[model samples]
Target: MSTPPPRRASAAVASPTAPLIGLGAGAPVLAFDVGGTDIKGALFGEDGHIRCLARIPTPVAGDRTGQAVIAEIVNLAGRFAEVQPSVNPRALGLVVPGHIDTRSGTAVFAENMGWKDVAFRERVSALTGLPVHFGHDVRAAGGAEFRLGAATGLRDVVVVVIGTGIAGALFVDGRPYDGDGLAGEIGHAKVASGPTCACGGTGCLEAVASAAAIARRYSALTGAQVAGAKEVLDRSQAGDPDAKLVWKDAVDALALSFSHVVALLAPEAIVVGGGLAEAGPALLSPLTARLDEYLTFQRRPRILAARLGENAGLLGAAIGARELMVAGGTR
Candidate 1:
């Protein structure tokens, strides 16, 4: 069976949110990075250029959560088709945050997204009649970094994304090392026996060091509600004593976690991404110093901000889609 030719879209890309860089010639593919709140969708042309980028609010559909998200993805594919009927995408890369089993293309679970046991790859492939490649969001984003961004040329790397929550993607010997979708869960590493994490685990690193945690910790300390971690960071920079204390604690927890990663994985580079990485030197400088104090005769990773920003996951999704086409896999 063949797909009917899609109608041409009137305008190219209405909202070009991310830049088209680093991507060269490759198969045309549709890509999506579904988060707990927002979903990023992109259309890549045969030239490996991003032709369209759109941010869509994820639907909160209670028990129908996975089904609702899949419906939205199918709808987005149609919308992308209308933009350029001539450029029919052959494959799709869909990444979602959770305990994803890429081997079976199953989304095992996501606490925030309210989904479990969703065979995303099979569902998307059957619905759109396009080969679908699925993966974990953080791991996919880490792949983009390993191939094209901050960790480029490094054989061993860890891509850490510090947003509302924190997660990591591990790369060793120039390849992603996913221990059956459970490898790089650095965020859950016990850094201190303090706050309870969302994962119901005590002393999880993200509970203390993540962007949301930083803001919450600051608000608890100073009795002042902050907009986000950036606000807390700014307050700290402006000589706010409470803010400084919160920030320092977060850094210390992060360093403690990284020290473990360095000692274990021994990644040469730890490329940081997401909202907290926006702090640049403010975060890395302190983190490096703290990590140094923890290690003796251990390789200190060169920490840097991710170049692709939020688009790293989207690019990783695109790469996965194109690979599917190359492998001649289709539903």
Candidate 2:
């Protein structure tokens, strides 16, 4: 696949007003952000505003095969097209959680969704009859952060999302470093010695610091069902010892992982997103303090919260689709 031209500098930097939206003029594009639990989609108009935003549960449970997932996305696109007859989507951008080989437009692996080596771009394009651009979900979100949200104006940065799982997307010298679908698996990096991961690995960072892991660990310790990580944080604030311990562990794990990133990549900032980041000061304050302790001489990067919220991935897909149009030798 041909590489798209570099995004315009304005497109790569966040604007003061509505930073999450891209800044280019192009034909309207349809975008899908496929996660483990849900699929969020939107149609981005030439004026850089999203329309017909929708969210639906992922078909992972109902459809064991990857084909059904693709079918559902095509169905959603059809619905969007039907709703907006006046606006035609010139291309489509699809992003999914997994090890994605973007060069081949293949979703190489996604343990949560149970699919591997699926040709997502080809399938979606053939079904929708529009040019398609495919990307990894976390990286796509990071792209949005880099170009239109938290990490804008930074050349070297790490955009980390701590949701049901943890992941990072690296941007060095104003370009995303995908590393053939394996660059930012920070969630899988070992941070402890015991907790087993869904990937059949022990002590992975995701097993400790992910929002899902925090709730799971807290529930196991108290033998009580909690709503989610937010609840756990609230419990900690209320002086629950178990919640405090679990939260501390998660913060420690994140600090350790970030220290490694700082040593290696020396990023200017680490822009954090996802459910856990909703803790706001509760997460950032301690994380910053702990991270400070870990860094001795390394250039400590600023830790900041993601500004785009949940729609970052969708906006990123739109950005990729617009770039794809340019790459296809069109507008």
Candidate 3:
């Protein structure tokens, strides 16, 4: 495995004006945010603005070997370059879900994707002819939240994304903590003594509280097939007892999981993002109230909604790519 270059300290913590110093306004960087269902790509211009944004379905259908995923990303990069011929990307950043070892640039494991020990940085760089920085998708989102989004200016924070699954990005002392690719698995934490999870664990927070879980649980109870968690939330608002019960279960599980986070990390804030977060006060208000019930004397962290929405991971990838350029000893 090729080791990544040491990044400059200021590169990670620099203000918004810092990236525009060199090459007239800094060099363009390519960023990709890979999710279970879609891959979002963007090219960050010299002025720190995203351009040529695109999203495509992840290539995981027949590419069990993970080569197709790489090929799809390479193709996306080629198209991005073709679309923006004037801007030659100096570096690339890729963020993917699963147990990612960013220090070694490996996608260690993604259960849903079924890829293990994929050398992401090396392969992507080999195919694209650029320096690459690989990162965990949720952690990258957390980095973006800390640097430019909801958790900015906070020293201790936890950014949790609750979508198909629940994952957390821990920022301790104002830096994202990976814990060697295994730190923030709050989703798998057992929050109840019921319902088995896809991970073969009982009572996992993700199984009970994730967006998919809410919809699944509602359907199991009422035998009503709905689209997703949003439909369940709407049903709850429409006075459906089953939907309300399912939603309450998810909120309770989330509150229970967050209570443990508060007692342990004592963060100043916890920024909640992902699809479930779109419910806004419907989720946050009840979550805060329940979390208060679980904590006795623990420091209460302000629960805030993620401000970046769907673009958080993409922006974080750009940040990582810019740091890679700085780390490669370039201005």
Candidate 2 clashing pairs? none
Candidate with top lDDT is 1
Residue-level lDDT of model 3, residues 53-162, one tens digit each, is 77776664432535667777787788777777888889988999988777678888888876888888889989998888888899888888888888879999999999
RMSD (Cα, Å) of model 2: 7.7
- Where is model 3 poorest over a 10-residue stretch in terms of lDDT? 6-15
Q: Output the worst ten-in-a-row residue range by lDDT, candidate 1.
A: 3-12
Q: Which ten residues in a row are the worst by lDDT in model 2? A: 6-15
Off by over 4 Å in 1: 1-18
Instruction: Indicate whether candidate 2 or candidate 3 has the larger lDDT.
Output: 2
The C-alpha local distance difference test score for the whole of candidate 3 amounts to 0.84
Encode model 1's per-residue lDDT on 164-193: one tens digit a residue: 889899999988998989887888988988
Sorted by lDDT, highest first, which candidate order results? Answer: 1, 2, 3
TM-score, cand. 3: 0.90
Write the residue-wise lDDT of candidate 2 on 185-246 in tens digits. Answer: 99998988859998889999999999999999999999989999999999999999999999
Better of 1 and 3 by lDDT: 1
